[model samples]
Target chain A: MKKGTMTLTALLACVTLAGSALAFGLGDAIGGAAKVWEKKDAVVKAGKAIRKGTQDLTPSEEHFIGRSVAATILARYKRLNDPKRTDYVNRVGLYLTRFSDRPETFGGYHFLLLDAPNEVNAFAAPGGFIFVTSGLLAKVKSEEELAAVLAHEIAHVTLRHGLEAIKSSNLTSAFTIIGTEAVKEYSGSQLASLTEAFSGSIDDIVNKMVMSGYSQSQEFDADAEAMAIAFRAGYDPAGLTGFLTSLRDAAKGAPDTGFFKTHPPAGERLTKATSVAKQKKLTGAAAPARDKRFGGYKL
Target chain B: MNKSFWTVCGALLATAAVAWAASTVTVSVKQTSVRSDRQFFAPTVATAKYQDKLAVSGQKGDWYEVTVNGKKGYVHASAVGGGAGKKEGSSIFDDDSKEPGKEDVALAGKGFNPQVEKEYKSKNPKLDFAAVDAMEKITVSDAALATFASQGNLSPKGGN
Candidate 1:
């Protein structure tokens, strides 16, 4: 009877151990299923977010895009390599930046004079990179006029008009790919696709800035904002009107290239800028000393 | 064993919760003045240098209220990274140790950066990256700008 009882006890112990092992296996299976479900849910959510246009380009992304765009612009036009003139333009641009809405960006503000003669145009790339043609520089007679032009370009940078010029479809694809990738390092194909998207986006912006130009409304808005920025900076807001009027007059004599081609009609811009200046009651004037310094830089 | 696991998880969650309550931002510009108010014309209260870390306490429009060295001040959102001190992502079971996303990677200067620029240059040899490089080297000091403003009768001191 004692032997039988001991065997029975040993059998019960084995059964208990087996039962616990089965339960542990079941628990692990459930945990693994839950983990798979969680990962799937995250991916679905990320996809949905991309579909909803919730992804916005970060500042650093904008900086990179701007660098590429700037490179493209530089490819077309050589930079005017005058240290004195560059320094002067930078000083004027930097002073306006202090009073502008966005005083700083990821890469900081830079002003470059493009060596394009008889092309009255100014371009503002993303990340506070600005380009002014020598033609526009030669056209402005006073420091306030230069300030006004720089302020307009600065407004474009601050409002991200250049970035906005990128095609929406390109941005969506780029953002979607970026959002869906969980790993920092992309595979060979992934990097290829990303580079393709990036180049396409850059092309879109270049086309808008150099070829098609921004919309009428965007130019009008920049003009309006320029007036406000110049007023706040103590520069005569009428300087924008003065610059636009000069452009209109110059258009009659010169070929319709650069500014005349890329921007809206100067008469419309001048009218709008004039109205804004009047509404704001801007009465500042260009100091003679300021103009003297501006004149010191030779074209 | 399960009890200890849950305890550790709970502690981590609590720490993350606290960290979320007060976000931190790093200054990205060379030097940014912490204004006494949100507007640009407001008085300068303190100066924050590049890479200076500040604990964000509140926000008003484009400016963020931050504390550095036990002093309260406001810095424009553009002057710091993580624009306005916004937290990127958060979830109960989210793994913070995972590799960063594209946005974070770009901000950290990892992917699609100088390396990519070099690659792009190799492909498009006509692009004038040397001029862009020179353009990037230009720097303007605050003192110089102030003097320029004063000389030109511009804003802040020119009595706009």
Candidate 2:
């Protein structure tokens, strides 16, 4: 195998092993150890190709992807039926999308407000699809902070992180099992599990495949991208660091829960994000007094 | 390998994705005037014609052609849930619901729920509730708020 493929294979192995250790018994790891590294190159190659294709997708193509991901997510948590929150999220998402590198003139980014007020999470997918919970929105102090979150999700789509991971893997079997709909259904943690099983070892490649995340470096890149997007949209870049710091602080005492457990530790992410913000001169940016008009949402 | 192959596969995948994505109902709104002097309107309203359940339509107007027990007549937008499609970029009704109605003077002294009232008081928490409640208790006439109100669906939430 080529040197790059070998290295990726080892990384994939570690990620899969880590997830396996978390979910299954240590005994199973010994049994499935040999099979992990096989076909590693093909999977990585496929992931790279998919990422490239997804990135190259046109505005309409991206929107189509967004709609699928958004629908699947909305269907899973059917309890939050508030249209006011839904409409508000969509309006804000669309507004942010207007400032993205690629804006959809035909069909702008559509948002679905998940009524899962307790789910402290939000996401953006290809094709301008986005979502946020009332729970997450409730914690946001300003519109700029909210915009910062949206911009980060937007960066994921622009970077084609999910598609790239899928492309690089020999996903014929997995695709058949989960399908694209499954991608929407699987939470970040669940994706992390899958990555461990597929990746021979664990590292960046496994991180991308299972958890649908970029590495620490990749995440920092995304943060920088988010800052630029927010700044360009006339929002303060400090919003990115503010929200990231809040997430880091919130994760400190909480149980090992949700996506944070799968990717890099929140503290490191927060530090890197702050450094990136400082490097970009975001610290000097003024906080604009703005209110998000989600008045009817009762927390 | 060629353009045709790529186009064909792309279209197929896109169509499949679109089909899977479009589960939610699409509602549209139209504006109409009401005859009542205490004319009221919600921020938005969505109504389905009595028989045509599949073809649901939304209207953000001062008066909506609402069907109550199959009897069609104009109802105050505020009486029903108000402002369905109008809140998005498009406003079908030119009339602003913010304009006061006759005899429906704003109430003084905020007591409806200090917390909710405080947050949403600017939207005129002082409703002519005597007149509005006389017509109907604080009901969500707008689609978004109605959506919020209907979360538990069985309970009534007081305050903004």
Candidate 3:
């Protein structure tokens, strides 16, 4: 009887020891899993940080911003319904794009004719959307002059002038919000604030392009770039000077509005554009064939 | 423990591999000519169209030397995306009816994107998106551009 009791006690002791060992083994496995998850979490966090902290907006973001801006402008002016004329503008615009430093945007370059007969203005939105008022088109005497106008607008897009017009403080705040909200989803309030920042950014650009116009320096830079681009595209660089000369003549006849209000004095612009053309020795003449095509389409 | 360590190592290695493989660029424009030299006025050797994947064998300033269909030439860097056909970011405001979930919100936080545009559109319903859509549909073919350039006496002759 004493041996039997001793054997039973030994068996119970073995069972308790084995059970505790199994429990310890399970705990180790769980701990290992937790460590792996922690490492993965860290990696994801780092990835998010990198994405949020990026300084410049990506091509996709630029595209969306430009699209919204284009929509806003279209809201104000009716698009010209003449497909033939519109196609002509696009062809010239696309040809010049080949010579631009940045020829491609996310949505590609598009040219539209606005039916603002009295407004002699051309505007470029981000993402390569360009608009020229019919009044400006009518003022252009030759195809090369039209190319010059389109090239100027294209220069604005390539140089990101519209994006630069946004207030620095607004951009900083928006970027900060983006960086802080690193998670895949934002709360309701966070989204609301982001939307507000976006609206402010759009407002800044609109005010600059429409109400106030870009600074004198920016306009001059675009004019210089346009001359270079038009020269490269085999158009007469003097086309810009000719267009400005016409504007100067017209401004003398009528009150300053639209293009005159938005851009620097035509006299100053003509001098600058002519100097640039002369310095580059871009003396190419407008092709007769291009003029023929230009004449086929009635503005 | 060993399995987890291998998994983590594998994930890291994959990320590194992607960075290393970024030498390839895909044409993003509708079409662009690959020139014998970096300059736009240089002789043309071949032409690449949209989504045509090319290996970026070399780079000079803003131009990239690409190999397409066994032929090597220089293409402007602006004509192609830096990496393969990979696009960054996720769809944030793809569908306006549904409330965006966490994943969508995260992507939207990347920058001002389609989601923000949707919200802006909602507030300003008068904006003419239809006209914008029509404008986006307008595309000039490369052949037409080439013809125009040649007739207009632009550089890089059409045949070459």
Among these predictions, the greatest lDDT belongs to 3
Question: Each prediction's TM-score against the native?
Answer: 0.75, 0.43, 0.73
lDDT of each: 0.69, 0.42, 0.70
* Minimal lDDT window, size 10, model 2 chain A: A22-31
lDDT of 3 at A263: 88
DockQ of 3: 0.16
Docking class of 1: incorrect
Worst 10-residue lDDT window, candidate 1 chain B: B84-93
Candidate 1 ranges with C-alpha deviation above 4 Å: A1-55, B1-23, B26-53, B57-62, B69-73, B81-112, B157-160
Give the CAPRI rating of model 3.
Answer: incorrect
Q: Model 2: per-residue lDDT, tens digit, A1-299?
A: 98668756655654554433322112212325453453243233322322222222223222323333343454454435666655555544444543454332113345555566555666554444555666778767666677687887776655555444434333332333233231233445444443332221112223452345566666667677777777655567778777777778878776664445445666786788777777766543433224424334436
For model 3, residues B1-160, the per-residue Cα lDDT tens digits are 2456546545544533432233355555556788887765566789887556666555556677777777788877666642111121121112211111212222333557566777878888999988998999999876788788887776631111
The 10-residue segment with the lowest total lDDT in model 1 chain A: A21-30
| Candidates sorted by DockQ, best first | 1, 3, 2
Error of 1 at B150 (Å): 0.8
Q: Which consecutive 10 residues in model 3 chain A have the weakest lDDT in total?
A: A21-30
Q: Which window of 10 residues has the lowest lDDT sum in candidate 2 chain B?
A: B102-111
Candidate 3 per-residue lDDT, tens place, A216-241, comes to 88999999988888887778888899
